[model samples]
Target: EDQVTQSPEALRLQEGESSSLNCSYTVSGLRGLFWYRQDPGKGPEFLFTLYSAGEEKEKERLKATLTKKESFLHITAPKPEDSATYLCAVQATTNAGKSTFGDGTTLTVKP
Candidate 1:
């Protein structure tokens, strides 16, 4: 069975503070790693898709990188408005679009 675990569970950051959220996983064969951001009462918004080791993607203040067994989501100089729940999910080779997801790391940035 594939499983994903996100670290810190929750984080509090001051405006302009940079931090990284972790997503660790174990799978038989990795198909892809996905990252998303979700606000309360809303569905997750797509952030990145990592397909191979060392692959990375970025958007605004967020950057996501993938490795053989884990992924990281880095927040750079975050603002209060950047606060959200960051979700990590992984798809295995035999599961097609099916994915095992982490509970997510909730981030709060205070001004």
Candidate 2:
């Protein structure tokens, strides 16, 4: 079965605290890895897409990288507004258009 799991369901970090979020996954074969950020009442916003191991994408203080078995979202010096749920999803050849999403890692940044 293809599945994705995120660690530390919730995280509380003081402003400027840097941390890395983990997304572990299991799939028949990975076609793409997606990273998204969601706020309190909005749908997820695309952040990055990783198609292969060793590939990475970055924007502002956020960085996403993917591997054969897992992916990571790293937050550096985060701010209050940066607080949100970080979601990881994966699409396999057999699961095309059906991206399985992790429960999500909720991050709270305290200013």
Candidate 3:
């Protein structure tokens, strides 16, 4: 089964706190993995895409890394404005079903 799971469900951090979020997956035929950020009442904003293991990308204070079976998003000294829900999605080689998405991690940064 092609599936993705994110850990911690939710996280609360101080304005300067740093943390990491995890996304684990099991896919029958791998194609690509995606990450997105969604703010309340808004659609998701594309963050990064990973097509192979060991690929990594960064944007501002957020860094995303991928592995054969899991991915990680590391936050560096996050600020209150960084509070949002982080989501992960995966696609298989063939389109027999909709892209599977992780449950998402709701992060709240307090000032």
By TM-score, the best candidate is 1
Q: Mind sharing the TM-score for model 1? A: 0.98
What lDDT tens digits, residue by residue, belong to model 1 across residues 48-89?
A: 999999998999999999999899999999999899999999
lDDT of 1 at 71: 97
Ranking by TM-score: 1, 2, 3
Question: Where in model 3 is the C-alpha error above 4 Å?
Answer: none
- Model 2, which residues run further than 4 Å from truth? none
Candidate 3 deviation (Cα RMSD)? 1.3
Candidate 3 lDDT by residue in tens digits, 1-111:
788999889999998889999999999876888999999999999999888999999999999999999999999999999999999999988874568999999999999
lDDT of 1 at 67: 93
What stretches of model 1 exceed 4 Å from their correct place? none
Q: How many residue pairs clash in each candidate?
A: 0, 0, 0
lDDT of each: 0.95, 0.92, 0.93
